[model samples]
Target: MKMKNIRYLSGTGVAILVISVFSVACKVISPDTGELALKDAYKNKFYIGTALNERQIMGHDAAAIQVVKENFNAVVAENCMKSGMLQPVEGEFRFELADRFVEFGEQNNMHINGHTLIWHSQAPRWFFKDDQGNDVSREVLVQRMKDHIYTVVGRYKGRIHTWDVVNEAILDDGSWRKSKFYEIIGEDFVKLAFQFAHEADPGAKLMYNDFSMALPGKRKGVVAMVKKLQQQGVQIDGIGMQGHIGLQYPAIDEFEKSILAYSDLGVKVMITELDLSVLPSPWENTGADVSANFEYQQKMNPYAAGLPDSVDNVFQERYLDFFKLFLKHQEKIDRVTLWGVNDGQSWKNNWPIKGRTDYTLLFDRENRAKPVVKSIIQAAQQPHSDEKKKRKQSI
Candidate 1:
């Protein structure tokens, strides 16, 4: 069905006003130019989201900011909301960038998400230390955890709709990471983080976010962990399967299995920090570890100038496959957030190995939607097999 017609106003000023007002509540798709907005295309199924870096949030890149506002309905902080950035010292809190981030989301009427409340990496050194610079006792750590969670989550309150309460606590092999939080507080750290976040904001959705979720070991570990939390009545709301994928790894079926397993826990499933790297990975098992870095190799940077047509074809197909899976199980998934707004800003370019060009996101360097954007929108708009069957029967 088409959008209803609107009569034109006389003056240019009045006509521009009408267009601006209609733009928010209704997207006027011109007959000549059938532009498909990503957020509008998938409005019924799930939220289309993107992460905002400091530059983008601060409006340093006006072109990228326009792309974000036009396409995505949800926003997550790329790094500003992390523990270290939010609180570098014991009692000090920095909300400069974070405040702007929340404001941007609010102005756009976006579903705002807090990147993390508790994370092993990108955490302040003071978070786990005593005055002597040794790890604090479990009791002290517990108190600190509560203070941090309450302060951060409390600040956002109802403004941020979702919080990654805990992130990457489980390793690829199903073992719990022995980060300072885990060493001092044991498994209850996850539980306590969830509890404190809930206390701060009862309305916000609390999520466990992780990468390499396609691994069987990690999948089992997450399912077991979430189940234990549920049994204890922790208010965990969702699981975020980080879509930091490459071309060869994470066979489609394995990814689907993880999605189904997480969905079975009766919680919303979110695809978070999602980016598909077109460049080769440095290691066979580099599972999105921020600390993992390797020396640059000439061979590693194949597409330094630009992605080849042959490789671009595969890249487009890979994105389509993931979107198809998302559309197939749209009922179980709540949100799908790209890790960055455009290829130029994507972290993949400088990760694992430095100075390698990567085409990872849906938008190109110029902030124009890539070919796959239309493919994804079209895939979402197409009727499902069941829907097609019903239509045939009706006819």
Candidate 2:
């Protein structure tokens, strides 16, 4: 969840072009390169997608869709109409860019996932304040929430495949992360938000997204909350685990438990905002000033030195392991969308939470696919290959 300063000038804006950097950068096999890992991980499924904006959708960043066409089965636009992009002004709405993004997905025949109808971050300033800077009333906030959801979702009714109706609402310890929306709307706001989104786009799948707290207590909380919502018939549809992993923290096993617990609700589960960073690094933290461009990291960036070439190999192996775990639970998994596209476009590169350089993402700064790309593609093309061998030997 990092951001770079991008100016949206008038005119044809930026000419977006999509290029394939896969064939040039990564060889299917090298004469002396490391052997391929994960014989078979993703046999019957494939969904390789990255987050996209207006410039990215039309501009020359075809790496996302190229991977989709080659490997991924789904595509998610990270911030299509967050408060900043859609309702920068209270009464006014903007859809020129969001419309174009949807059109691109429709034209390309890609499954479009609309990221975030509600979030504690990246929202408009006017959302919390009145003309004289007074906090708006609860009733007013509810109306505003309904209006925004109505206008946005009503516009894209059947077009969007899934909506992250709520994002990052929970804290690392599994409690509400207190925001203006919560202040105005209260705890019930969660239920209300989903209810409104469901009313607006009945066909679009609705998901509640959060990060951290993958432990059983966390799982218990999510399951309990979603279950209550289900009991109320809120049309929750799914739960999104925002797989923002560091070198450690929500250990691999914890992630597995989350997948199983959320899927027990008989709804879909998606890895929404996914990026890994080797920590002891600083990341950007923004508040109040929307135009702020401060590099605020709690620690130093890990990839300051050029990432070692062999580390690239380690990255590929890690991808194999992660995908294998996902494939093992493929029955419960519905989609896995990368948080950003390339090293250059990732927030990990600049502002607040810089990972120094290309610490995350499938492609490097040049948009070339790395060993990670190869490992993921290989796994997706061959699901259960390893399991089959084991079963055969037993027979």
Candidate 3:
């Protein structure tokens, strides 16, 4: 009887150990069992989106593509839809890549946003000059702008839900960048761009997109521009605040102020190109110009090997704070799009300092959702603490 009892006790112990091991495994894989999707988390609030690179559009990056389809409800072409890639030459347009991009969005029933119709940078030399390399006449530039806007917007008419009709037009100090568009066609170029886009696709939502819009002067300039468009009877529907943020610039209060400022204009606000760079900045202040380069230094790219846990913890917290603010103002905001699908594919890796590994996205290089993914979902699931306080105060 003693021997039988000893064997029974040993079997029970093994069974309990097996059950514990299985429970631990379940907890490890529970976060992203593909059960909680970002889009669904904010379904009634606003669209969750990510920009697609060429590889994603062509179905080359299967893992990235799956994440996009499963988590995002809207899509924007990162570069393929831009002027440099779409119409590199004069009067000749390439639509193969852009077409595939649109098709991909349609297949997934995602909201499609045309990145930019007119911008100072990334435009071919032929756009602003004649055959003899002289600056094109005002009439010539206007015609070129109209043709490009009509062709692009018209092709994707009724499909593209919104467009960055004019990008980065306002400078940080409440002045225009004096690009060839502003130099030749004057400030009214923005008005014309909006009119032409409206004519091409009257139903599509047109937006003016820019970075550093959270700054006071830049926010004022954008508000003035939108007002000017409205007075001219132009159909400007939204403002895309390009959220190329850093660790400590543009305080949360400043960002929230801009959201209120833009929303006061009665236009939908979008958080476009959202990425937070963990590396050090080369200059005191910089714009998102790809041509903006800085001297490479070891200190600049400290995380060249990998992000330390300490830095990553701060990064995740910053993202959580921003998403919480976004949820609080979901009524005015229309969408929040991560700049890229994963950290491995982020533009921050090459900008300012080339050949640097920077982790500026929600997904890590392995294409796995980072801890911030759970935080954002939780933010969406529960009322913000501020909201709870407001409710109690009202009572």
Candidate 4:
């Protein structure tokens, strides 16, 4: 699809401008003239997925579900599968919401990814403390980890195809985070998490997920961890580079380097938790930390009403560029999952800064596919001779 003579507008007018441009520019005749499904476009390359929230899982958001069914072939629970939400108390599991999420994926015939089996954040408070509120012993913590993984992984063994066995364990400076799992169980907790996940459901692909993977230090740390797991026969299948990005950060070259680095380890690379936030960051190096908080400022939340057309153009181009890079390295990349379905449901709205409107997804607040969707499809369908030449020159 080609957009011609596009004009930039501001605020809520961005969507209107996009729709008008698409109406005129999307003239290339293809099988579908109405709405192009992303899954169909990238079916041959890799799985296209989105993270589903309770609204979509419980069938409350019919339009979002419809969009999900049409565009995505894989699904991951956004918050339902997290430890805090899944099992809030010791020895107790809450499978009602998660079960519904898995069923939704099954009903749609989509590849299901368990958002996380273990993580530093979102874990229940009781998981680390003993009866007296002191830190649990190594043995007790290890046992707790085992039980949690076994129950969660075993319940949806065949239905879930992939599991984020461990999430965000390494910090950006090539060091381990001082999470309870690390403090008590030591560095081996990651290996144990993968092992328990593998034992519970041997068929599911186990992955180590983290943000800032493109940073040299974090990438090296993750690579070392993966190699160690491989040496120990831990059965790790992939690495999830959380693609929570913005307009300026994580340059394309750096992202490509991380992908190639992980792929070199003979593991599939998944662009997980993918979202491009258009809002300004409070700090220079802030990432997608759910726990990180920032004072709300009106200037920071500039697009509360709507994203400026210029910002919308930047968002579209940024997504197109990343998709182009993914397509260029499709052989190494197994899946690319949007963090959420649409702008309205994005975690960016409340993360780091509360009540900020963020235009960080492919679909707008109204569930209409942005003009960038067509651009991505076109990028996937077309060949990249320029990239091929660059690769040859580098070789």
Candidate 1 vs candidate 2: the lDDT winner is 1
Over the stretch 114-222, how does candidate 3's per-residue lDDT look in tens digits? 9989999888888999989999999999999999999999999999999998999989987888899999999999999999999999999999999998999999988
Stretches of model 4 off by over 4 angstroms after superposition: 1-35, 385-395
Residues 1-395 of candidate 1 have per-residue lDDT tens digits of: 22223334447867887778987677744221156688888889999999999998889989888888878899999999999999998889999999999999999999999989899999999888889989899999999999999999999898999999999999999999998889999999999999999999999999999999999999999999999999999999899999999887789999999999999999999999899998887767558999998999999999998899999999999999999999888889999999999998999999988899999999998887888888888898898776787799999
Q: After superposition, how far is residue 118 of candidate 3 from its true place, in Å?
A: 0.3
CA shift at 230, candidate 1, in angstroms? 0.5
Name the better of 2 and 4 by lDDT: 4
The whole-model C-alpha lDDT of candidate 2 against the native structure comes to 0.68
Candidate 3 clash pair list? none
Kindly give the stretch of ten consecutive residues in candidate 2 with the minimal lDDT sum.
31-40
Model 4 lDDT, residue 17, Cα: 73
Against the true structure, whose TM-score is highest?
A: 1
Give the winner by TM-score: 1 or 2: 1
Question: What's each prediction's TM-score?
Answer: 0.93, 0.80, 0.90, 0.89
Which parts of model 3 are misplaced by more than 4 Å?
1-35, 384-395
RMSD of 4: 9.0
Which segments of candidate 1 are over 4 A away from where they belong?
Answer: 1-33, 386-395
Per residue, candidate 4 scores C-alpha lDDT tens digits across 337-367 of: 9999999899999988898999889998889
User: Residue 120 of candidate 3: its Cα lDDT?
Assistant: 90
